[model samples]
Target: MDIVLQQMHYCLTDDASNWLVIAISALLVVLWYERKRIKEAIKQDKTH
Candidate 1:
């Protein structure tokens, strides 16, 4: 029982890591948006 629980825990963590990587991969698709956001924030700070 304990071994099965341990295996399940590990599998869940592994799957979670994969999901996190996939989510982060989507950010790469919007590289321009991220750059634009950063540029705008910098411009705003300069104005302030």
Candidate 2:
């Protein structure tokens, strides 16, 4: 019983860390995409 509890705890923490990494990656991608859009907009304004 004790071993099972320990394993369960470890799995939960591991899953939590994976989720954190995924969330950070998603945020970075979103930021990068927004930056690209802003740069394009700036270039268009310069043309006008």
Per-model lDDT = 0.94, 1.00
Best by lDDT: 2
> How close is every model to the real structure, measured as TM-score?
0.60, 0.93
Off by over 4 Å in 2: none
Q: Estimate, for each residue in 1-48, the C-alpha lDDT of model 2 and write its tens digit.
A: 999999999999999999999999999999999999999999999999
TM-score of decoy 1: 0.60
Per candidate, the number of residue pairs that clash is: 0, 0
Model 1 local distance difference test score:
0.94
Across residues 1-48, which tens digit of lDDT does each residue of candidate 1 receive? 999999999999999999999988887768878899999999999999
